[model samples]
Target: MTTSHETSLPTCELGPGGPIVSRLALGTMTFGVETDESVARRQLDEFVEAGGTFVDTADVYGDGASEEIIGRWAAARGGVDDLIVATKGRFAPPAGSHGASRRSIHRSVDRSLRRLGLDAIDVYFVHGWDDFTPIEETLDALTSLVRAGKIHHIAWSNVTGWQLQRIITTATLGDFVPPVAVQPQYNLIDRGIELEVLPCCLEAGLGIAPWSPLGGGWLTGKYDRGQRPTGNTRLGDDPERGVEAYDVRNTERTWRILDEVMSIADEHSRSPGHVAIAWLLSRPGVASVLLGARTAEQLNDNLAAADLVLSDAELGRLTSVSATHLPPYPYGMIEDFCDVDVWKRLGTASSA
Candidate 1:
């Protein structure tokens, strides 16, 4: 496997737009919530200097404060044309919204544009699928935006395989602009997407941009088995976000796997976070991994993953320890049919 560090950071075109972006995108979920304006500005400057053009934010992130911060940085930097900004809607304030209704979609994009200080968004995503609203209506609204120049491309986040497929089918039939990318929760510990969401993206020709690539800092080996992180840690400060990280089953397994990751990092003289991010970049269909950092030191360490390449032997060992079990039925059946040996020997040699 080729490490991102061994060569220049990869670039991919955003949908049909001409703007090119680095393979590693900076996520701004913690921009305003965990990090203040000064720290956020420093991180943004470092990222731009590192050749990272892709910036991901959401309308609901810190109630739009994240987008505002990013907008300020972009304006101050005076290179808005060179950046590929991607922000999501449908997760706006007042909390617990169902789906992307026409009114909500319009309002959300207008608010996002105001917060971003831009005339249009480079790429926009439906934060999550809405079961209550008709999928066609949502696609129609998004397509209208594309036609009106409000957004350049459409994308999806936190959607299931079936939902993604349905949206694609609707767009194709309606001649709407199909989604060009997907954002999902994917990492060593959260491999559920491998069974469905990933395959759907591959089949549809949509790029995969995974969020929480470090498993919300779990893969960095920061939290102990029984010790809870407090204060600044996302898990400690946010009760709602902490539940997933604090799961007993997941905590035990994450620590166990961290032992293996630590060994690999030690061999390469890198931090565990670097190794963890590298492992995600090694996976198939991973166009980029979204990483969030509160401090410049943390950001620098995470950025080094762009240069850290794991040898084939190291990748194999990490895979063995971190691979999760597939549930019975179609998934198990598919795994049995598409064995690893057959995959490497006869399957298509595409970058995962």
Candidate 2:
């Protein structure tokens, strides 16, 4: 593994005809919580200077303080139109009605706009599928919002592949405002979405804005192998995190993944987290990677990945080492069915 690498960030369309945004996005989940407003502002400034244009936040984050900070910053920076502001709805908590109903969405969007001081949002996410609210009702509400100029585009997070396909199909058939993107947990360790969500997005023209590109700081190499996580780190501070993470991720599989990442990091002379982020940026269907940090230093360090375009060999090396195959059944059978003999037999039979 070699450690020397350099890459540059660039803008791409969020989806088909959607807004063009930076390859890397800033996630403000820690604002007003682990990171105070002052430090959060500094992090935002540094990120924008480093070519980041997409900023993501949820209404539930920091009890709306995150959006407030973003609003204040946008006010000073000459309004929200300059940046591609993305915010989420749903999960109202104490207010109840935690679904994408007409009432829920209207309330969420109004509150988000008030907090962010914006009239229209760039990408408005549903946060998650609201089973409590009929999908049709949710779609209708989103379409109304678009027509009313309240939201520029609609998006969804934490949804399944079938669910997303249905939503896109229904929207298109009804001429409603279609969802242009999806935000799912994606990283070296969490590839479950690759099975369905990634494929659906590829065909449906939905952009993939992957969250947890750092795997909750696991890919940062802060946790040592075979040792209890110690110190003030995210997982170190919470002992239960290790037990939960180690349940499926603590095996030769992860060790190999970490080892290869460290090797690549050494070759590039960057942090393992940087290498991880670079690998994710190269993945298909990834419009932007959501990078979050508790401090400006972490944000700067993660931003280094923007310029790293992994070599073919490096890409192959990481893919082979870190890839996890899905269990037997549909995925296994589908791959196994693709064979020279089977292809010839099927072709002959069809021709006959």
Candidate 3:
């Protein structure tokens, strides 16, 4: 049995030996947007009191208001010296420039430092891949930040397999500070990253901090089939909102996966979300799973998953049911004639 405030969750290194963070990281994307400061502060306090140490946020979240909220929280608590604070800076670039350009990155880092009330960011992530800027240019700017002590470790998010490989190649050749981690959206309903991105990260020895592990609330079992959400839910407010829109995710496959998750939850007497998150934690190369919530209660509910380890049979069932078919071109071709077991390499079913 666990105490009220003690999560008793394990820890993992972000990179091989980079900053050690709690297995479940608190994501502050809802700060100052869906949630006010007081609630946000409560969530942060709850997270830390429950043994969470990594807090992730981005400069564009709430148009920098999220960082400001976190900054105030840290100020009230004296400082986040014990926490591994991470923030991204590839969304809001300077005027007339791309987000990943040298000028934009330099400006973004300074602003993030000021907003977070920290001398140096613990883990600074480039929010996404920027085609407009060369990978070398971005790597150079990040290397300079490391030297100046403005940032400690570097990471990337929302990149493809080719892009990530290129970044690693460029940084290795140029002697730049390589990324310690890569953040991608990985969940049962969205296992697209397993195709190439996951393999690349595993090979490069980069930690994967996965976002949207609950498939934007689909894996939570809160939404029903054939019924449109109509409340204060993420889809209710705007069914056609972002990637997790109602219509987009309301498919047969989604319901099948959700049913399996609910079955596992019932067996464990836990929330469906607990099953979803537990499954992610069982995967390889998963350093931390980012948990985003709109309220303290939601965050607390998510924290319970730390203690819920799924059985091998249950995990295999979920993985099998949610497995996607691989494309026909290269992945399928290689598996067919080359005697190379792509399915074993992927650790999942070949079908996408």
Candidate 4:
């Protein structure tokens, strides 16, 4: 059933026929880590007050304290009956080799439900692809939970393009319920998902709820060229680790993207993070965007992106600058053909 609140945020179906969820979701990865329980509760209350219902958490975050904090908050705020609490499993907790076995799913869901103080979870995601276990086995386990009503929906996260397609196809042909959503690292700086993973999810009708919408805080305009971040921020405390994390995205190309984002933000009088998220929300096949905030104040600031709409030109500028230049064999060549005058009239893949 749809959690009825009638908030101003645009709503979308979680999947083909799943429950109603806000287009923007609150991510609690930092619940008990970067943010304490008191602040975590404040963030939760702020999110709900701002019309957000779909919350993304994981069993492994903060060594499971994230879910625990959310659990307490849900209980105190009139119970979890009206909230769509989404969490993930698959990463073993300290001692196991890996998870996602039938036994693991069974145990994980039970523990999650217990912690969340609910009889069932709104959505349960496999944290990552378990190479040790067969995809069929994982699907069977997830479907069993669905059959038992332990989880309302099953989701996938951090899976490759082929892995996502394989699982969806396997489920369809094997007569198991398909995944309702796929979570991946997506942002203006990380458009790698657009080449294959995105098209696959779109083709299969699965919802895309991208995490790290701010590009690991890179798009927030905090990092500087050749300068180490030094603060209580995500990268500031450990400059070495910050540089290592920054190594991947500290590029001339990324700087150009950041410049454009800042320009657009200035035009609209918004934060760079807000512009980045607003750009992400305007993408196609995106049912929801996960905003990971470190504090309630930051969460409230980012929430304004939900209402900030960019002009078509501004959206196209970001898209054009960040467009993926895929390999020439299939994607690039096919897109080239689509640009032909004749094929253009017939409609191209992107226009679909």
Best lDDT among the predictions, by candidate number: 3
Q: What is candidate 1's TM-score against the reference?
A: 0.89
Off by over 4 Å in 1: 1-8, 14-19, 93-98, 238-243, 248-251, 334-352
lDDT of 3 by residue, 1-352 (tens): 1113334678888975579899999999999999999999999999999999999999999999999999999999999998999999998999998999999999999998899899999999999999899999999999999999999999999999999999999999999999999999999999888888888888888999999999888899989999999898888888998889999999999999999999999999999999999999988788999999999999999999999988899988898888877777787777677755545644554633
lDDT of 1: 0.79
lDDT against the true structure, per candidate, is 0.79, 0.82, 0.91, 0.82
Clashing residue pair totals per candidate (backbone < 3 A)? 4, 11, 6, 0
- Worst 10 contiguous positions by lDDT, candidate 1: 342-351
Clashing pairs in 4: none
TM-score of each: 0.89, 0.91, 0.96, 0.92
In model 4, where is the ten-residue run with the lowest total lDDT? 343-352
Instruction: State how far residue 86 of model 2 sits from its true place (Å).
Output: 0.2
lDDT by residue (tens digit), candidate 1, 198-294: 7777667677889987877777877777766676776777535642556533455677678888999899888888998898888776777887988
Better of 2 and 3 by TM-score: 3
**What order do you get sorting by TM-score, best first?**
3, 4, 2, 1
Q: Which whole-number lDDT from 0 to 100 does residue 68 have in model 4?
A: 93
lDDT, model 4, position 240: 44
Model 4 per-residue lDDT tens digits across residues 53-104? 7888988889889999998988787786656889999985334545877778
Best by TM-score: 3
